[model samples]
Target: IEGPDLISKLRSEHGVSVPVLMLTERRELSDKIRAFRSGADDYVTKPFDIPELEVRLQAIVNRAQGRPATRRLTDGGLTLDLATLIASREGRQLRLYPGTRKLLQVLMRASPSAVSRQELEHALWGDDPPDRDLLRSHMSAL
Candidate 1:
C-alpha cells in the first residue's frame, strides 16, 4: 500500500490523532478525497509554496494544542482577534494602535481573572519593564 493507505491503516489500528498533511505528486480529486477520508487533516500537491505549508502545519499544531487558530477573545460584546489585531465593540470596529491591541489581547485572554499590573507590564514590555505610568496610559487609550 502507498503512504495514504498506510496512514489510514495507522489511524484505524492505533487511534492516532496527529494531524497529517499529504504532500504527493499524485493530483486527482479522488486521491485527495481518499486521503481526507482516511483521516488526513490536509492535502497538498507537489510544487507548493514552503511558507504556505509552514502556515498549515502551524495551524494543525494549534488545533491539536486546543488553541484557536484565530486567537480571539470576546467579553461584553467586545471582539478582539489577535491574529488580525482587529478589535470591535458591538459589531463596530474600534481603531486601536498596535500597542493598544496587544494590551487588549492580554486582558481579554485573562478575562474573569485579574491579571496583575506586573504581568501586563511584562507582557507589553518584556523584561525591560516600562515606566510605571506606561501601562496605565495604554489601558486608558484602549
Candidate 2:
C-alpha cells in the first residue's frame, strides 16, 4: 500500500501542530513549495550552514513553544478557548475531567473534520496504547 506524504501524514493523520523544519537534499522550488504547502514551518535545502541550520531550528522551536495562535473555536453553543484549554457551552463552563478536557482540546482543534483514531490515540496515549479500548472508553465518557 502507498503511504501518504511525510508532512501530510504528520499534520493530517497524526494531528501534529508543532512547527516543522524540513532539511532535505532536494533544491527544487516545487519541493520547497510542496513542503510549505504541506504544513512545514520552514525548509532548508541541503549543504546548509551548520550555524544557520541551528538558528533556524531554534527559531521554529521557540515559535512552537511561544504564544499559541489566538484562536477561539466555536460550534453551535459550544465554545473552546484553545490557548486557555477551556471549554464551555452556552457561556457556562463545563466541568470535565482532566482527560476529557484534554480530549476536548484535541477535538475542538480538529473541528469541522473527523479526527483519525490514530490521532486520538496519540493524544490519549503518547506511544503506548493499553490493550483494552481505553481511548474509546474515554471518548464515551465525553
Candidate 3:
C-alpha cells in the first residue's frame, strides 16, 4: 500500500467512496495537479497543522457521504461498471479469464504506467509465492 499504484487501486478497485486526503511535502503546482488527477480529493502540503488537516478530512468525508450515487466509469475508450465488475472497450465486451479480468482491472486503473511484477504477484497470490509462469500466462491471455 506504500507504493504509487496503491492510490489507483484504492480508488478504482476498492470503490472507496470517501474523499482521499493526501499529505505530501511536494511544493510544485504540477505535483498537486497530478495528485488530484490521480484521484486524490484533496492534497495537504507538508508543514501542515494537524488540527486543520483533521478538520479538512472531516469536511470532505461529510460532503462525500451527502453526494449522489455514482454509476459509471470511463477511461479513454474503455468503460466499466463498478456495480457489476463488467468492462467494455470501444463498445465491445472483452472476454477475459477470471484471473485475467482481475489483472486487467488493476492495470486499467493504473493505466499509462507500468505496474511492477512484484505488485501484480502480491495481488494475485498474497504472501505465497505464485507459479513462475502465472503472471506471464495471465498477461498473455489478457
- Most TM-score-accurate candidate: 1
Clashes of each: 0, 0, 0
TM-score of each: 0.54, 0.49, 0.47
Q: Candidate 1 vs candidate 2: which has greater TM-score?
A: 1
Q: Give the 10-residue window scoring lowest on summed lDDT in candidate 1.
A: 50-59
Overall lDDT per candidate, in order of appearance: 0.82, 0.73, 0.71
Candidate 1 lDDT over 1-142, as tens digits, reads 8877888889999988788988989899999999999898898899997545755775787788998775567899999865466789999999997678777777887888899988888878889987889888999998
lDDT of 3 by residue, 1-142 (tens): 4322566777789887556788888879987877777688888988997545644664576578784343345779887654455778998987776677667656765777889988888767778857869799998987
Distance from true location, Cα of 69 in model 3, Å: 8.3
Model 1 misplaced regions, further than 4 Å: 1-65
Worst 10 residues of 2 by lDDT: 1-10
lDDT of 3: 0.71
In model 2, what is the error at residue 14, expressed in angstroms? 28
lDDT at residue 82 of model 3 (Cα atoms): 45
